[model samples]
Target: MLTHTKFDSEAIANHITNWLHDYATNAKVKGFVVGISGGIDSALTSTLCARTGLPTLCLEMPIHQADSHVSRAKEHVKNLQARFSNVSSEEVDLTSTFAHFKEQVPQAGTQHLTDLTLANTRSRLRMVTLYYFAGIHNALVAGTGNKVEDFGVGFYTKYGDGGVDVSPIADLTKTEVRILARHLNVPDSILVAKPTDGLFGDDRSDEDQIGATYEELEWAMQQNDSGKVAADFTGREKEVFEIYKRLNTINQHKMQPIPVCKIPLNLT
Candidate 1:
C-alpha cells in the first residue's frame, strides 16, 4: 500500500463548501444535481452539496441495479435530507433504455464491448437524466469523481460521468476521500463497501477491474508523474498500473476542454 500525506477533513470540508457556494452563485446555478450510486464517492458528494445549503437533487438511475443498491442510495439521501434543505431524491429506471441500445448495436466479436457498451450507456443515460433535471431546475451537475479515479486511472466514461459543471472532490485522492468521509460522519456501510460503478453484476467492483487497490494505485501515481512507475507494485498493483495507463490514454479526450482555433489577421 502507498502512503500519502494526511489531510485535515475540517479544512477540506470548509474549502469544498466555500468553492461550491461560489460555483453556484457565479454560474447562476439554482441548485445541484448529483448521481447517487449508493457508493461512498456519490454519498460524500451528495452530502457536501447538502452541506452547502443548495437545493440538491440526488437521482438514482438504476439500470439493472440491485434492490439493495437502490435501498442504500435512498438511505444515504434520507440521512442527507435530515441535515440540509431541499434534498429531494428520485429514481429513474434506465433498464429499457439500455436494452434498446443493446439491441440496436450489433455485438462485437468480444465480450469487451458488451461490458464497455453497457457501462457507457448507463453513464450517458445517467448524465442525460441529470441534465434534464438540471435544465428544469436551473442547476449544475455536481460530479462525484475523485482525483484517484479521474487522474490516476481515468476510470470514467467520456461525456458521461466525465461531464460536469463543477467537481467538488476532483483533487482528493481516494484515501483522502475516505478520510474526509469519516470526518463528515458518513455511514460506515458506505465508507467500507467495495467501490464499484454498479454497471455490471452485483459482485462487480472497481478494484477487481483495476487489478490494484486504491492504496497501491495512489502510491504508483505519486511515484511517477506519467503514472508509469510500477516497480514496487505487487499482487494487484501491477495490474492496476496497467489499467491506469490504458484508461488514461483511452479517455484523454475527457481531460481536455473543447479546442479553439487561432487565426491570423489577413494582410491586404
Candidate 2:
C-alpha cells in the first residue's frame, strides 16, 4: 500500500513567491536563468521560477546530455511556457566545446584526470552559460540542488552547480521534492526519470554513484537526527553510516560561505 504525507501546497507557493520576489528586488535581478537538464530537479526549479511570474530562461546544455533527455527537456519547457508567462527557452550544444577540449588534452594518457576534469568541465561550462545569459538579461542564476543531494552526500561540484545567486529548494529533501513536484503537477516522465548528473552516460544514476538508495540514505539521516546511539548500527550499517558521515564532514565547506579572515588595523 502507498502511504501519503500531507504538504501545504499553497504555503509552499507563497513562500517561494515571496523568496523569488525578494531576491530579485533586493539584488536588482531582472529574472531567473536555469540550466534545465530535463531532470526533476531542474524542471522543479524552473517551474517554481515560472510560477512566481518571473521571466524564467531555461537552457538545455547537452554536453553529454542524451538525445532522449534533450527532447524531454524541450517538451517540459514548452509545457511550462503554456502555463506561465515570460518563460523563454533555448537549446545550446556544448558537444563541440567538450570535444575540442578533449582533443587539446589527450584523455588516453590521464585516466582519472580525464573523467574528473571532464565531468567538472561540463558542470562549470553549464554554469558559465547560465551566468553569461544572466548577465545579458540581468537575471539571477537559480540553483536546483535538493537538500539530500547537497547536504547529505555533497553530490555536486564546488563552484560548478554550487555557484548561484539563490537556491530555491535547498531545504527540501529528495522525498519532499517529489512531493512538491507532484503537488505542482510536474509530468510523470520527469518525476520518475532516474536521477543523474547527466555528466556521464545515460545509465549512470545518482544512487549508483553514491552506493546507496535515497530511501536508505534518508532513513540513516533520520536516525542520526534522533540522537540515537551508534550501538544501534550493525557491521554493514555502521560502515554505510561512517561513509555518509565522512562525506558530510569532508564537504562541509560546500555548505558554508567562502571564508574571509578579519584583518586587524594594528597588524603591519
Candidate 3:
C-alpha cells in the first residue's frame, strides 16, 4: 500500500466539489449524470457532484448484474439522496436490452471471445443509458474512474465508462479515493466492499482480472514512472512490474488521443 503523509482530506474534497461546480457553471450545463456501480468510486463521485449543489443524476443501469451489486448500488443511491437535496436517481434495467442486442449480433465467435465482447457491451449499454439521461437532463456524464484504474492499469472500457464529460477523481489514487470517501461519510457498505467492475455478471474483482491488488499496481506505477524496468526487482515485484507494463502498453490507445489521418498539402 502507498504510505500517506497526512494531507487534508476535507480541503481536497472541497476543492473537487468546487472544481466540479465551476466546470458545470461555465459549461452552461444543468448538472452531472453518474452511473452508480455499487462501488466506492461511483459513490464518491456522486457525492462530490451532489456537493456542487448542482443537479446530480445517479443511474442504475444493470445488465445481468449480481444481486449484491444491485443492492449496494441502491444502498448508495438511497444514502446519497437522503444526504443531498441535489442528488436524484433512476434505475434502468438493461438485462432485456442486452439479450435483444445479443440476438441482433452474429454468434459465430468462440465463447471466451464472445463473453469478453459482451462484457464490454454491457459497459457500452450503460454508457448509452447515461448519455440518454444526460441529453434529456442537459447534463454532463461524470466518470467514476480513479487514477489507478484510469491511468495506472487502463482498466476501463473505452467509449463506455471512459466516455465522460468530466473526471473528478482521475487524479486520485485508489487509496486516496477510499480515504476521502470515508471522510465524506460514504456508506460503510461501499467502503468495505471489494472493488469490481461488475461487467461479467460475477463477483470477480479487479485484482482477479489484473493479477495484482491496487496497492501493488500503484507501487508498480510509481516505480515504472521512476524509469525502473522489470530487471530492477526479482520475485513478486518483478511479476507485478511486468503485468503493469503489459497492461499499460496494450491500453495506451485508450489513454492517448485518437489517431487522425491528415492530408498533406501536396496532396491537397
List the lowest-lDDT window of 10 residues for candidate 2.
Answer: 1-10
Q: RMSD, each candidate, Å?
A: 2.8, 2.6, 0.9
How well does candidate 2 score on lDDT at residue 121? Answer: 85
* Model 2 lDDT tens row, 184-264: 878888888888888874657887777776666676666677775457888867766766777777988887778999889
lDDT sort, best first: 3, 1, 2
lDDT of 1 by residue, 57-155 (tens): 999898888766777788888888887767898788889888898888887678997777777878998899999999999999999999978876788
Candidate number of the best lDDT: 3
lDDT of 1 at 193: 84
Every model's TM-score:
0.89, 0.90, 0.98
Per-residue accuracy of model 3 over 1-268 as CA lDDT, tens digit each: 5787785899999999999999999999999999999999999999999999999999999888898899999999999999999898999999999999999998646998888888888999999999999999999999999998899879999999999999999999999999999999999989999999999999999999999989899999999999999999999999999999999999999999999999999999
**Who is ahead in TM-score, 1 or 2?**
2
Which pairs in model 1 have colliding backbones? Answer: none
For candidate 2, what is the lDDT? 0.82
* Ranking of all candidate structures by their TM-score, best first: 3, 2, 1
